[model samples]
Target: MLTNDRIVLKILKNNKRRPLSAYDILDKFLRIKRIQPATVYRSLKNLLEQNLVHRINQSNKYIVSSENSHENDVTTIVVCEKCNDYEEINVNKFKMSLAYNILDLKNFDLNDFSVEISSQCKNCKT
Candidate 1:
């Protein structure tokens, strides 16, 4: 199941910003193999649990997970709603650690590991 999920992740990595929905993936996979949605969902769930993939909230889309810090497991994701362009914000500065500490103090689950801050891109704005 995990290996199959990685196959799905590889597909996702090749197409960033497309934000494929579950049904979309199901339909695609069904054409190649006779797998049920439940099976795919199960695998996806496991992948998510292992932090090998991520789900977009409000949108219900999936994408490959960004590599995180094993030491602190810290990462930040930036998303553009208009274009659906995503970027991984490498938290090199102290501010990221400060915010992480603050958030941990507040006790947010934040399990999915995504930061969906929406704004128009310069191209979109223009």
Candidate 2:
């Protein structure tokens, strides 16, 4: 990993409780270092390719990949719509097999998949 990549990873790790946009990462560094948006983006791309980070597509933000995740683990992300809080759950192998069976029935190959479930979190509930 390059210096910038490490820096980006540190930021994500530090803020694991919430997702952050590229601008968020860039803003954090702007106060201390002279960094460009492109550099932050490049670091994010590389981290994603390496499976060191995961993107919340709905909100266009990124979070650090869980430390306990495995190669075949299916990630189910629960997003709190009201507060934007999110959590990643590792679905068990049985669920994974079910997904594979569905794909097999359709003669489709599965490389990677993400399941996003949006709902109000406990704090947001009435």
Candidate 3:
């Protein structure tokens, strides 16, 4: 891996449980490296393109991608609004049916989609 990739990976690994924005990652790296926002964003973009990271659309944050995730699989990320915790769940079977139904109705080709649901987590609710 490249230097930027290593740095980004280290940051993600260090905060594996929660998602982080590019600014958050940049802030953390500032202590050890004199990095800029563009550098952090570039690294994050590369990681996202490579599927090493997953973006939570609702929260506008990124999390380490699960090793078990597949390129063709439809992954749904459920995030806790209160605690900011998230979990990725594969909804391939549901996605296939939903995609086909929508495509049949609209006559449009479906390429990619991401679903994010926000709710208070069990721990956060207690």
Candidate 4:
């Protein structure tokens, strides 16, 4: 049997660009490989520890890391309150946080970067 990380890497490789959730992984395993959710979550936690994936806080979902580490730019997430559907803002097209001028007011150290935006998506706006 392939190791957990390899299994996860294989899944990510197959998806290429699409984000896969822990539940989705569990579902896939149940359908195709018969693995348990706890196992999958453990593998995911391992991946997170290894910096191979990142947790998207807006939707509380996980996505394969685009960069290994030291990821620059803000991870914009858009959440809808009504339908509960959320999405990652098209971060490639815009300078989400690059334009901000960070000035040290009282020497407050800032680390990590992400922007949470809650609004009605196109489908929910109707």
- Tell me the whole-model lDDT of each prediction, alpha carbons only: 0.68, 0.85, 0.82, 0.63
Least lDDT summed over 10 consecutive residues: which range in candidate 1?
A: 68-77
lDDT of 4 by residue, 1-126 (tens): 788776876675566445567786777666657676788889888987765766666556666655523444455556666665556543532254345433432565345456667788788788
Q: State the lDDT of candidate 1 residue by residue for 10-54, as single tens digits.
A: 667777667778887777777767887886798789878777777
- TM-score, each model? 0.74, 0.86, 0.85, 0.55
Clashing residue pairs, backbone N/CA/C < 3 A, model 3? none
Q: What RMSD does each model have against the real structure?
A: 3.5, 2.3, 2.3, 4.9
| Model 2 CA lDDT for position 120 | 86
Off by over 4 Å in 2: 92-94, 97-101, 104-108
In candidate 2, what are the lDDT values of residues 1-126, reduced to their tens digit?
349888899998999888999999999968757887999999999999888898888899999999888876777788899988888888765587686575565665556677788898998897
TM-score of 1: 0.74
Better of 2 and 3 by TM-score: 2
Tell me how candidate 1 scores on lDDT. Answer: 0.68
Query: Where does model 1 exceed 4 Å of error?
Result: 67-71, 92-97, 100-114
Clashing pairs in 1: none
lDDT of 1 at 45: 91
